[model samples]
Structure formats: structure tokens, C-alpha cells
Target: MTALALSHPAVALLLPLALLPLLRTSATPQAYPSLEPLGGDPLSAVFSWLLRLAGTVAIAALILGIGGLHLKGQTITKTGEGAHIVLLIDRSSSMDNNFAGRAPAGGEESKSAAARRLIKDFILAREHDLVGVAAFSTSPMHVLPLTDHKPALLAAVDAMDRPGLAFTNVGRGLALSLDIHERDTSAAARAILLVSDGAAVIDRKVQETLRAAFAKRKMNLYWLFLRTAGTRGISEAPPEGEPDTPQAFPERHLDLFFKTLGTNYKAFEAENSAAVAEAIAEISKLERNPITYVENTPRSDLTGYAYGLALLCMLLLALAKAAEVRIPRGSPA
Candidate 1:
């Protein structure tokens, strides 16, 4: 279906001017003294008509182009299951190690590499979900924003290329991820999937701010803990002496903190790539419940087509003039 729209609709009021060419009168008299001879030749008469018609068409096409015509169409895009997921990833040095709790050598797959592959897979499975990604070490770095464009999302995931600072600032990572959500006011389903093998203490004020955001937006938070072998996971309780500190059992303490946020929260602990995949698969199932969303198809400009048609008409007009048979004024030389 094709529809034409003018960028400058006001210019369309001048479209009547295109007809001025039809009323064209020669500023100078034609070489032929009278039109009586022109009528005797059928081909000559047809050529005159052809030339005028082509001129009219070229003028019309040019007018339309000046008016900025655009072909508009409607595309009914179904926004699949509504979930805006922001991947809050950890970029600490530990992420450079493999799932077997060993440091990666050249060309070896590390925790970050495996996580990236699995996350890319997860995105492929959730075709409708708008996802963003962020990475944190000393501070949070926003790698991507909430977008459903698969290539951009995958590229952003791949960009977590090297090990970051040794410190993990989960607070700043969470703050940045939530800020991405706040940027979009839509009430569509929201979730934050935090993938990290470590945790750090969050500031008290930031924690309060995060809790408010969680409650107001009614966000679902899932922590995918990629545990290193022999390290305490989310299920582990803090040591008796360091229960008050988040440093001793950082993952578990953070898990507890998440549970108190008064919004939907869950934690999944994974020690291997397979386990991480399984955790993402489980989250996939839980978030599949349908929610309404709107998709937009951008308008397309078609002035090039108009311009091309105009060019064709001008070429035909030139050819007709070139093939014209003109009578000799005096003697045939």
C-alpha cells in the first residue's frame, strides 16, 4: 500500500502553479511563419504533443518533489510479552576466571565469556523483551540502554571484553540500571537481571533510593549468582562473627537485602555455564506471562521515486526532440 504525504503541506497550495507551464507562449515567434504546414505531417504533430506532455509530467514530478512527498504505510507490529530487562553485570577481575575456579589463559573461555554467550542466547529466546546491559567494577558503566534491537544488545554484551577493576560496586550498578528504567515512563513489565559472581556494600542512601524505585515501578529483580567453586553462594549464611558485615558472605547478604525490597525478588546461584543457562531458562518461564505493549514503524520517505520518474520523463522528452523531423526553410542542403 502506498500513500503520499507532503513534508511541507503548505507548499501544496502552490501545486496549481505547475499548470502554468501548459499556458506557456513562446517569448519569440517560431521559425515556421504559419502552423498550416505543421498539420500536414502526422509524425510532426504527434511529436509536438509528446513534447508538451513530457514537459507537463516533468513539471508535475518536480512540484511534488519540492512539496516533499513521502509514501506512508501502516505496519501492525505486535509487541510480544512485555518485559524490559536490564542486565546488571559484574566486571570484577574474578569474572576473568572460568567456572572451574581457574584463571583463563589465552583463547580460554572465562566466566564473562560464558555469561555473554548465554545472555545472548537468552535474548534470542525472548524476542519481544526489551533488554539493556550494564557492567560494574569500581563503578557502574552503562553498556546499553533498554532496546529490543538484537544486534545492539548482543554487541553490548560482547563488549564486556576485558577484566575490570578488582572492586565490585554493585550499588552504582543497580542505580544506573534503575535509572535506565526511569528514563522510560511506560508501565510495561520491568525486571533487573543482575549477573555477578561477587558483591560489595551499597550505600545506605542509595539503598533507600533503590527500594523506593523498586516499589514504585513494581519491578522484578533476579540475581544470577555465578559462583566460584568453594566460595559461599547465595544460599550460604554469613559467618557467625561477620553477620553484620556484607563483606564476609557478600552474595548471601545481598540476597537478603534484595528480599527486603518489598517487590518481587529471587536469587539463582550457578557454579557453571550449564547452571547459568538453566537459571536464565527458569527466569524465561516465569516472565512469559503476557502484557500489553506498543510497537512503532517509522515513516519512510519516497521523494527519490518521484525524482526518478521526473528524470525518465526528461530523458524521453530529449529523445523525442532529437528524433524530430524539421522541414528545411529554403533549399535542402
Candidate 2:
């Protein structure tokens, strides 16, 4: 089952629910026999059984009290309306490749830098949508959780520092984004926008598992492939393999990988800053589908139940103490 994602407003309202336990009383006092079994010659075992039953009820109450405390700490509720879009960015060492566009000093812009710019523009365009960022290299890393704070999310985008390794794990980033979106049950269509220049080098079994997981959520996967835009001077284009029928871009395996995304997926060839921004904006449009059903917020009034339990437990302990305190005087005849 998919986990529900709680909005900020819902979290704020339920945050206090965690502290209700500390405010209530401990336990109720037991009635002292009006006249202590005076001159009583065995009132029968019936009274003893009655006392045991009362003690059991009190113990149950204590169990209830402990449950109340547990409920408060992990309260989750659904709030706000609209679809959630998570941007899963690849921040492995390959993202640092300085080959998109170069300056006269022989230095070029990195793929991640381009991705950051595109994401910032996209966030500015649609600040209403709840969006998050996850940057991954060898493992998935959350740059920002789902939120409406555009500025903060953008900062997360900016914070995707390139790892020193020379490879990227595309699947890891995708899996993490899906996990986040699944938690937010209010989202209508959980969509992921992944920008990467290379395929994941992880094992095929792992990749298949990741693919199955994504399919289960029916997630919309969008891809923005960044490649060299053919600078007027540099001639070392990553070997095109004897130009097949003179196509604009030769049929690389990357095309097939993206084609697997099918209809919901839109593959955009963005080798420069402007195209990257356009592709992101286009995907944002698709991610804006309205949410149909909003789950009823969990009505956690377990506070009262908790207090009752504590009272019950205290009563039991008190009874036990009283039993220990009773001094036997040979039947008060």
C-alpha cells in the first residue's frame, strides 16, 4: 500500500496531539472499605474475586494510556489540493562533464549547472504545485522534500554538487522520487522529471526491479537528454558510429531506453540552457493534473482513550501496593 503524504498545514494542526498525554492526571483513588472487615468471619471468596476483576480493568486502562502516547508522535493528515511533482536529478560525476558550451579559456558549463537553471525556471513558473528535488549519484539523496516553498526547493536544486565518481545511477534517483510521491497520497498523478546525460551503470537486475516498482505506481517518467550542441570549433563528437542514413542524431541506445517510457513520457533533446528550460516547463504542464479524491484526515482523538488507560494502570499499581501494605491480624473476631 502507498503511504500518505501529509501537508504542512495538516502537520501543524496535529503537532500538538503529541503532547496531550503529559497534561492528564495519573490514576483514580480506590474506595477505602467504610468499615475494615471488622468482626467479619470470612465474607466468602466472592469479595476477593470482585477485587481482582476491578484490578484487571485498571490494568487495561494503563495499556490504553500508553497507546495514546504512541498515536501522538506519528500523526499524519492530508491537506492542501493539487498534484505533486518530484524532480529527480542525477548528480554523479558524469554530470560535471564540461562539454555543453565552452568559453575561450577552454572551460565549459557542466550538465548539472544547466539542470539547476532549468529547474529554477520551472519552479518559478509553477509555484502553486508541490514540488521536491532528489539528487543521486551512486545512491539516491533527497535535496528537498515535498513542499510549496519555491525558493527552498530551488536551493535544493542548486545544492546538487557533483560527486567525484565518473558515473551516474539513473535508477536510484527515480526510485527515491517515487518513494516521496507515494507518501503524498493527495497527489493525483505522481510524476518524475529526470535529467541525465548517461544511463545507470548498475546491474540489470536492479534496473529491472526499479522499472517494475515505477510501473506499479503508474508514474509518468519524463526525460531530458543533454548532449553537445556541436560547438563551431570542437570536432571530437562522441563517436557517432559511421552515420546511419545521415540522420540528425544517430540511433544511440539512449533513444531506445527513453522510448520504453511510452506515451506518458516525453523525451526532449536539450543540449543547451534554453532547451533544458523549455523541456522542464513542458513537463510541468503535464504534472499539473488535478487530484480527484482527498483522503479524510485521520481523526486521532485517542487522547481521551490514553488518559483513561493511564488512570486504569495507576489504579492497578495502587491496588497492588495496597495489597502489599495490608497487615494480617488473625481474623478480627
Candidate 3:
């Protein structure tokens, strides 16, 4: 239930003025020989009391209106088909290149640009999802907290395509994303949407921490690998002569690490914008689960309603006055 509040509590001090109508009579003074003749006039008594009541209501309502009545803001829990998603975006310098691994020219779109466009669309399509955004290059940067606010989410997605740093620090980025999820206590379907064009070897200690974190929380992990031409894919084996190590084959090793985390993990290798869109659509389809999210309602003003009641009461009083019969001093009672 919404709670009632007043903007100016001092104005409520005038509420006692409403009692004046009951204490004092509004009828004009008239001279009469005796009160015995009107002793059984119950109908007239009822009408008289009704007018006083109307006056009291008008005064009280006006006072409340002046006091600025309103309903306090409230947060409500709502159930819907959505997930708590953290968009872990890559902001490496190489992300600015196209799928062919060159700077965007003519109609070609950079990997970051395509990711931004598709992710924004994905966010809009999931109306009830609680989304947070984080970007990582040299370090993980928390862009936005988990929220259902669409405008802020769109703004965060728009900022992802900005010029990026030199390194792709995926370990710290995943840790930050896990921390974001940890801060939220909502019991909803949780997922991490990792968008990156390249991979970096995570430190051994950081990898242990990530493994522990992933084990503690059962979450869906999605890696949207924007693969450039002639580059290694997540599942591609190293060349016959090359050693198969994390340093030599980071993407494949990262995929192997995610699989070992024992969570629902999937990797999508998109070579262009269309492929990225298709992958996003698939992820959107997989993350559909019943979720209970919090929705906040802002404070609502009730001053106008109070004033409207006062006006209604005044109109009743006006009608009563118009219907009243005036008896002259010398006229028969």
C-alpha cells in the first residue's frame, strides 16, 4: 500500500478551524415568541446539521490541499519473463576494426559499433530484464548498475563504442561482472553477456578467483566472440607446429576455462553484424525465465484531489443557501 505524506506539515495546524461551523450558526437571526411551536421539527434539524457538516468538510479539505498532500514513493515487486543480465563489453583498441581486421571504411561497421547497435536492440526487446553494463580494456570499468531503466541502459550501450584502451583484461572484467551480480539480491535468472573481439590470458590467481565465483553462483555465461578474418576462433586448434598454451591460443583456452566453470556456457563467433544479430537473438531466446524484479513508483501529488473535494463541498453549501427561505420581520412564522 502507498503511504500518504504532506509537503508542508505546518499548514495542517489550521485543521481545527473546521470545527467553527459546528460551534457557530450560519442562519440569519430571527425573533420568535417561543420555541414550543417548532419542538417537533426533526426534518429541519437534519437539514441544518447537514449544512454545518458540509462547511466543516470544505474547511478541512481546503486545509489539506494547502498542506500539499501526496502519496510517498514505493518500490513494488513484479514477476515477469526476464533475466538479470550484466553486459560485459570489450573496449580494446582492436575492437574499432571491422570483421576483416581493418579500420571501418565506406559502409563497413566496426566490431564495437555493431555490438553497440545489436546490444541496444537486445536491451529494448527485453522489457522486464534488469541490465547492468561494464566495459573492459586495461581494466574493468563499471558503466551502469543492474536496473530496469531503459534510458540509462541505452546511454550505457551508446558509450561502449567510444575510443578504447590498449589491452583486453578479461579476468578483471569477469570478476567485476560477478561482483555486480553479487550486490543484487534478486532471485532471478542471471546471465553474463560477454562481448569481445579478442582474448587475453587471465592471471592464474585471477582465474582461481573467477572459478570460485562462478561455482558459487549458478549463472548462464555467453561469450559473443566477434571473430575477425584469419584470426583464431574459440574452438580452433592451434597450428600443427605451434604449442597449445594459454599464451599461444588465448581464445581456445578461455573457452576451455569457461567450460570447466560448470555453468551453462555458450560461445558465439560472429564474423559480421548480421551474425552478431543472430547470436544475440539466440541468447535472448535462451535466457527467458520467470524473474521477480523491483519496480519503483514515484511520489504522486493529491493536492488537486483535495481541492476538488473542497470545491464540491462549497458547491453544496451554495445550493443550500440558494434554497433557504427568507422570512421578513413582520411575516408569519
Candidate 4:
């Protein structure tokens, strides 16, 4: 079943041109007494019908040639695999300093710089994933929306390569990060990657909101904590012969809170750039979910074929009319 589509459908308004021969009468001069001789001649009747058929066919082909008829089709296909990932970064003032508690020198990258570099690599590594960026300091900033456009996501990450504010509003940032996927209707997997070194106490209401958001979807939560030298972090261990001391560091307590959020959650404490790269590598492994995409084929033109057919029919008409015979009227014996 093929469908014909016209590029300029309005051109069909000239369809009445094909019926011109049918609407008008054409008279042929004939020598006859009382017009009875030609009416009874079988050969004359056949010639008249043949002439009309040829004229009608020629008119139809010409009209269609001008009208422009074509067939168009579209297809949607799915291929490869990917997920929707949101990078939630912390931009507190302390993030500007290197993990060694000193300003970065000799081109040494700071914690935030390391995270940004690694996150950019993570986004580029995925082939079809929709990646977004969100960073927070004293407040939440929506840097980018979820999208499969890699350059825009990478550029948005690079834009945050400046100084940070004083506060670290983790709760609000996390809450805003959840909103990135709230209205998603795609089948792609969802995940939030948090890159931060310090932790701030979240308000009770904010905590409740985050908890509800986590439970509302099947989302993966990964925290890539930048652990400065000689500072306690989310993975703080107890002394020998003692139980685990999760409360020893504020980040550890935050880790505990995330553990209770009823989602697939994991925390990695990276002490250096190498560790940061490793953490992102692990994340790349987890983002192997299958994704789908659509490809469109270019439209093909059919007007040329219509015009050729019209020309061929007109040519045949010319040959048929040339074969017609006529006798001299006054020379008959």
C-alpha cells in the first residue's frame, strides 16, 4: 500500500484542465447527403472513438505532470543503550583549595577541578546518555537540563570552573537535582551523581522531601566524596577493637542519611585526582542501560517520473494522429 503526497498540494486545483476535451465538442467537416453516409460507416465511428481516447489520455497525463505527485514515508528506530545522569556538584568556598589544604600550584587541580574534569569525561564516555549539571553553594543552581547533547553538557560543566560561595546547601541541591527527572517520560535509566567534599546539616523538611523523592522513582544515587588529606570522610572507620564511628565526620553522618533513603545508593571517597577518575570509571560501568534513537531517511522526488509519463503519452498521440488518412474532397470519381 503506497501513498502519494504532493509537495504543493494546491497545484491540484488545475485538475479541471484534464476534463477540457470532455466538456467541449469538436466538429469535423464531412461531405455527405443528409448526413446519413458517415453515420452508418463502421470505420468512421471507430476512428472518432480512437481520436477521443488519445486526446483524453494526453490531457490527463499533462495535468498530473503539472500537479506533482509523490510518495513519502517515515520510520522510527531504536538503537544502542544509555541512561539519564545528573551531576550534582558542591561549590563551597573551601572547594577552591587543593586537597592538601594549600592553593593549587604547578597546575595542580583542586578538588572541584578534579571533579569537573572527571565528570566531563564521564559524560563524554557515554554514547547516547542524556546528561545534566547542577551545582550548589549558598543556594541551588540549575546549570543544565537533562539532554543527550554532550557539548552543551560539557560546556555547562566548564562554566562552573570559577570561585565558590560560602555555604554548602546539600539538601536543597539534592532536592533540586531530583526535579531534573521528575517529569521524565523516557524509558532510559535515571541516576544522580553527587560530587562534594564537605557536608552541611540539612533542614528537617528538606530531608523529608529528599526521602520522598528518592522513594518515588527507581533511581541510582552515587556520591563521589572528595576526601582532603588528613580529613575524616563518609568512610570513617573505628579504632582497633571498636565499632564503626559513622558520626566521626559530618560527611559520614550524611552517608548514613543517604543509606536510609530506600534507593540503590553508594558512596566513594576519592582522596586524589586518580581516585576521582577511578570513581567516574566505576560510574561509567553502571550506565550501560539500553537506549533508543530515531533516524530519518531523505524524501525522494517523484515529479520527474510524472513529467516523463506525460511526455510519452503526448508522443504516442502525435504518432497516432500522423497515421490518420484524408482524401481530396473534389477529386473523387
Candidate 5:
């Protein structure tokens, strides 16, 4: 469905049931409904207890009434609703492995294929949102332009089927997304959704350049880290009968860089294709607060109302106490 077709301010339906207590009587009224049976002992403690009970019920009713009113008054208006999204995908050799999730035992879906499956799902689901695609291997490449053209985007995703060891370039990928977003005349919210299996093989200078560019443009960063068990055809073993010590891939350095980037970026760790799609759906709904609301975040003002009701309860208690004092003990007047 198109994002525009989706409901705004998403409704959270709540049913109020506590108001019923307000209509109930303060106590199990004696058949005559009065304290006459207490020997008219106005100072009878039972009368005071009844008054306090009534006050407690009244306060509860007030709280329920206020909650219902707030719910009824809720409003969600679309301010700058049509936003632009950039999808950054990694196409390194590790993306060609079988670790994502064993595709049914006999299936032929490779790792990149599975990731593309997720990309397609996300694209198809976003009917109204403008989207762009950038694929990163040795460097970032703009495979698709920013547009609402679903078919083109899907085709592009399906076409990225390189099966060799390619280095990752996250910084360049992000820079490309920023460039595309700059072209838009009225982008409501410019955001970058990066999907990769950890770090890039780019230099620090390039990474800094991308970061500065994004900071200057005031864009939000969303990172998705697709996990990998390891790449296929990689042999960690030594010659037969030969002793071998474990050696980490040079990519470990790249991993550290991404860890730092992920710290500042909105990150998602996708264990498999299904998770990737789900993450996209969730991230899409994350609404950035309007810049104007930056100073004072809205807060629920139930405290004042609660205090008022509490005071009413205290008043009821006092009245009940006074009535108890006037009544005589054990004698009907």
C-alpha cells in the first residue's frame, strides 16, 4: 500500500471501563440508606470509613474520565509527510555465501539473492514513498535513481548478481545517497537506509568526508548490518596433517570502522532476509520529531488532575469524620 494511503497518527484504541464505579453507592447502605442504625453516634468510625471509600471512588472516576477525554482528543496530522528514502546495499563476496539462512535444503538461493529478496519486498511494500538504490562493492555505485518507480528498482535489485570477492565502500555509498537527496526540491524527511554485512574497505579520509557531507546536509543515518558466518570457498585449514593456527581476515580492521559508524548511526542487525524486510518496515514508521518541537518535548499533564482529585478525596474524608463525631455510639436516635 502507498504510504499516503496509510493512516496517520496511528490509532491506539483503548476502552474505558472504570467509570461504572462512579455510579455505585458509597457503602452497603442499611435498608434505610442512612447511619441511623449506628445509634445516631455521629462520631461512629464506620461513617467516616464510608466517606473515605466514596472519595476514593470519586478520584478513580475522575482519572478514568480524564483518560477517555485525552484519547478522544488525540490527533495525528501529516506535516511534511512525503519523505525520500535511499537504500544502500553491499555486494561483497561474503554476500554470496549460504550463511544468511539455509534456503530449503535443495534451494539455490545465494546470500546476495536472499538479501535482494528482502530488498524487493521492501520496495514493493513502499508504494508511496520515493526510493533510490546504491550498491557498494569496491566502491559505491548508483544503480538506480531516486524515484517511486518500483519496477525499475526491483529490476535493478535482481540484476546485482556478481559472485566474486569485492571490497565494501560504505562511505562512498552514503555520499551517493546524500547527493541524490540534494536533488530533491521538497523532500519532507531525507533519510539513508544502509544495508551491509558490517564494514567497508574504504580509507579513513574518505569516511570522514562522507560523514562531514551528511552532517552538512542534515540527513538522518539508518544502518543495517547483515550478518555472515563466513564466505564460501575460504579454507581456514592448513595442508592435510599440517598444524594451523587461526588467522583473522584483514576485514577485521574494516569491522572496527563500521562498529564506530554503527555507534552514531541508526543500526539494524539482520540475521537473515526476513529480518531485513522486517527492519525496513519498522524503520519506515520511525517519525522524526518536527524540528520545532526540539525545545520542549510534549508531556502528559495528568499530575495536576490527579492532585485535584486527591484533594476532593481528602475533603470527603473530612466530611465523613465530622459526621462520625456528631453520631452517638450504639444508640439509635
Candidate 6:
């Protein structure tokens, strides 16, 4: 329900002036020596009352117009086919390199640039999804909150290509992405798309907290691992001589950690930009679900309508005055 409101409510203090028209008539008065033979005419009495009512209406409308009447803003719930998604992007300095682990040259695009382009296309395809963006290097940066606003989401994606810090703080970034989802109370399918060319060992304490959070909230998790040429993959096992540890193979261990969380997790190892695009397409196909979201409608102004009504009433009063009968001086009483 929408409620009526006023911009200048103080102007309503003068509303009592509308009653003045009812107290007195605008017609000229005629003198009479006696009242015995002069009887009230029914038609004249009705017409006089109508004119007073019109005058009252005009005054009341004018007061309301000055007060600046309007309807308050509203929030409407809508059903749509989309999920609540958070894009957790890696912004470490390594993302600036091409898939071959070198500076992009001769029309080659960096990993960050490819991710931005493909993510923007994904956003545009899901017209109804509420999306948020976050980036991680040495720390997590909250780029945007969950919203269905497309322009802002695209702008946030555009900022992901900026020069980044040295470290890949994956654990904190995941925590921030989960927090963004937690704050949104809407009933919808939840998913997190983590895009990175590499990973770092998560702290034990952070891993426990993430496990607890994941256990509490069931959501889809997708990792788009942009693997460079000759680099280790997420599922690759270490060589025989090297000890199997998170420090030696962080990507493989991170993938293992996600699997242990009991959420629906999938990892896509993309060797190039085309592979990344295909992985994003698969994720899009997987996340289609019914969602309930709230959309806000801005307030509407009714000042012009109020003034129009006042003008209508004044026009009626003017016509009544022109048709009024006048008694000449010294006419019979």
C-alpha cells in the first residue's frame, strides 16, 4: 500500500480558511422593509448552497496544492528466474599476464580483461539476477553489493582490470563473498563464482570458519581456474619426491577444501579465453532457479493534479457569478 504525503506539511495550518466561504455568501445583499411577504425560493436556496460548496472546494484544493501532495515510495516483491550470485575475482598482479604466463602483446588480452568481458556478457544474459562483485589480492575489496542494477554491476566488473597487489588472499575473499550473500535476506538460489589464475594456502582458522558458514548455508560454488601454460592444475598430484602439502600445491589443496565443505562445488580449468567463456556458459546453465526479489518504485508527485482541481472549481464559481441576478438601486422590496 502507498500512503499520501506532503513536502511542505506546515502549509496545511492554513486549511481552516476554506470554511470562510460557508459562513458568508458572495452575492450582493438587497434591503427589505418587511420579511412577512418575502419567502425563501427553493431553487435559489439550492443554487446558493452549491456556489458556497464550490468556493470551499477551490480554497481547500489550493491549500493542498501549496502543501505539495504526493504518494510515498513503494517496494514491490517480484518473482523471476535467476539466482543471487557473487563474483569473487582474483586481483593479484599475476592476473595481468596472458594465459601463457607472460605480458599480453600483439592484441592478446590479459586474464583479468577476459574475465571482465565474459562476466559482463553473463550478467547481461541473466536479466533478472541480483549480482555483487568482490576482488582479492592481499585483502578483500567489496566492489558492489547484491543488486539487479545492470549499469553499476558492469562498472564494477570494469574496475577489476586495475593494477593489483602481490598476494592471493583467497580465504578472506571467500569469506567476504559469503558475507555479501548472508546480508541479502531474499529467498533465491545462491552461487559464488571464483575466478583466479592461482591460489594460496588458506589459514587453518579461516578454513574452519568457512566450513562452518558453508555448512549453515547451502550454495553452489564454482571456480574458474585460468591455468597458464605448463602450470599445475587444481587436481594435479605433486611429483614423488615433493611432499604433498598446501604450500607446494595450493590450487589442488584449495580444490580439496571446497569439496570437503559439502556444498555443490565445481571447478573449471580453462587454458585459454575460449575455455573460460565455455566454463562461464556452463555455470550460467546450472544456476537457473526461481527467485523472489524486491524492486523499489520512486515517489510520485500530485501537485499538478491538485492545482488542476482548484482551477476547475474556480471556473465553476466564475460561471455561477456571471449568471447571478442583480437587483437595481430603488427597485421594489
Candidate 2 whole-model C-alpha lDDT, 0 to 1: 0.60
Instruction: Give me candidate 2's TM-score against the actual structure.
Output: 0.53
lDDT, candidate 1, 1-333, per-residue tens = 556798888877877765664676212233655767556888866766666667777877887888888876565556567588899988898888887788977777788888889988999888778888888889889888888788998888887747567899998899899999888777678899999888877878988988887777878999998888787777666657765577666676788889899988988888888888899899998887565555556677777887988899789877765665576666655
lDDT (10s digit) by residue, model 6, range 1-333: 979988999998999999988998766676646656879788878988988998898898899889998998898988877899999999999999999999999899998899889999999999778999998999999989998899999998898888888999999999999999999987789999999999999999999999999998989999999999788888989988999999989999999999999999999999898999999999999988988877789999988998999999889888977877675769765
Across residues 278-326, which tens digit of lDDT does each residue of candidate 4 receive? 8889888877787775544456667788777667756766675576455
Of the candidates shown, which would achieve the greatest lDDT relative to the real structure? 3
Off by over 4 Å in 5: 1-82, 100-105, 162-165, 230-264, 287-333
Candidate lDDT values, in order: 0.80, 0.60, 0.92, 0.78, 0.60, 0.91
- Candidate 5's residue-wise lDDT over 3-111, tens digit each? 1111222321222333333455344433333656666665646654566466655565455444432222233433433357787777777666655444334676666
Clashes of each: 0, 7, 0, 1, 14, 0
lDDT of 3 by residue, 1-333 (tens): 969888999998899999999987566666757788667788988988988998999999999889999998898988888899999999999999989999999998989999999999999999889999999999999999998889999998898788889999999999999999999987888999999998999999999999999999989999999999887788988889999999988999999999999999999999989999999999999999998877888999999999999999889889987876676678765
**Candidate 5 to native Cα RMSD, angstroms:** 17.2
Query: How would you encode candidate 2's per-residue C-alpha lDDT over 202-278 as one tens digit per residue?
Result: 44675576667766777777777765566321122445575432132332433444455443666776767777777
lDDT of 4: 0.78
Q: Estimate each model's TM-score.
A: 0.76, 0.53, 0.87, 0.67, 0.50, 0.88
Give stretches of model 1 more than 4 Å off.
Answer: 1-20, 25-54, 62-77, 106-108, 238-244, 291-333
Structure candidate 2, residue pairs in collision: 4-183, 5-183, 5-184, 58-312, 61-309, 62-309, 62-313
* TM-score for candidate 4: 0.67
